[model samples]
Target: MEYFGPNGDMYLATKKLKRIAIVLKPQESPAEFEIHFKRPDADEIMIKTEKDAELPHNAAIFHSAKTLVESVRVNDNPKKKRLVEDYTHINDQISTNETAIQDTLAYVNLTADIDKAGTTEHLNQIKELTVSINKEKRRRDSVLAAMIAHDWVGKREELDDLLQSDIQIQTPSTSHEQLMAMYDKLKQKGDQVAVLQSKLQNQLSWVSAEDTSRDDTFQELEKLADQLKDELDVLSVLENQRQSVCVGFLRSNKGVHKMLVELL
Candidate 1:
């Protein structure tokens, strides 16, 4: 169970000694904690940590520890609570990206011997993948920095809108080069429609192999790519110029136009 501290810090109820101990980890954040497990006294409460018990002066002395725990402060500290929530969101996104990177790493397909065949293309892909991951890490850090200090970005709303635009236009998963490479092959399939579709099926497996928790992998991008492939298949039957076919396909598919615009 969860409990709230007097200052809106969150605490998890845990067991330790005959008493209880709440560890203070996040100095800022939910502190972001606000957790305490302790034994009850008539007027005071005693809090403990994992290994060490507090002496007289070292203990946290709250006038009404009971009142603090019992009292509800849902609307009391909006700013701090919001900050805690945002911090959590940023961390979750970072975790999602880190997992995606690992999944992509498995698909890297590099051999121990550098001189192995097809190694150059795989190496280039790994290099590009590293650049993409680093770019995302920087973006994550910049978002956190903006949360803390917005002066560098001129206005907070502008930054917010910019990030919102990024989400709509360049979803985190869809922006990776590996997926882009797969899409490129589909877009420029030339006369080899069957070959392209078969190849894309294998590539789609790479995408489908990623954690389904990501919105774009199994749901959005895979669906979008399939739709685009169907369109391309029809165009290939018509034997239209590859360039015109790709461009025309984008213009006609209003649903995916915004997303495919970057590739064009």
Candidate 2:
């Protein structure tokens, strides 16, 4: 007699009346079976077999099914695990970059304040402050580059714009009085910028240290980006204010030059 096992493999047994049992495992008892046969033709017979086949058959079927099921489960889980690990690593990188950016911003703002205050002092102090501001600006640029590499598009753009405006403000011109006035306003702006930058740095440090998930880092970065944008707007206003003052000073100086020329 031939029978299909749970594994879908075929097994054959002799039709003798001797003991025939199917033992699935060495620790389990062999299930007994009663076989009835009726000769249908000269060379063919119909055989019906009975036993406690349901329990063993189900167990064998479950075992076979478990192999395939476990295999599929094992194959599927690793991709999810890898994805989770990748996400975690990316989050940690972002947090680290955010902290660096904030630190740079704080230093930039502090230097800007010093630039403003020092500009109101003697010529030597102003020159020293300019050098300090340039150094801080370069450091800030490096941080902006890192932020860009980390996919912080908005902040990178904002910092770039601020640096450009600072360069324009620092350009040499002959309107000492106008420069002084703009310098005063710049000092106030610098103080505000410094405070904001410091606050952002503190927040970023706190978030990086305490946050386990990337979501918090993302949120904090977004907030910092927005604040930076607003500060850039203020810088634009400062630029416009300085240009107006400088133009007025130039016009007055031109008038004085024309008066002297006519007098001569």
Per-residue CA lDDT of model 2 for 1-264, tens digit only, reads 644322343333345633223324223322321122222222432222333333444344334333322332111335433433443344445445555555655655667656765434444443554565555444433332232233223454553454456654543454433445564675567566656665555555444322334554445555654665577578669857765544343244544323323322
Residues 135-207 of candidate 1: C-alpha lDDT, one tens digit per residue: 6555544433333342223454553454456544433222223322433453344334444444445444454
List where candidate 2 sits over 4 angstroms from the true fold.
1-182, 207-214, 255-264
Q: Positional deviation of 181 in candidate 1, in angstroms?
A: 37
* Ten residues in sequence with the least summed lDDT for candidate 2: 33-42
Which pairs clash in model 1? 9-34, 10-33, 10-34, 11-35, 28-31, 28-32, 29-32
Q: Global lDDT of each model?
A: 0.40, 0.43
Model 1: what TM-score?
0.22
Q: In candidate 2, how many Å is residue 234 off?
A: 1.2
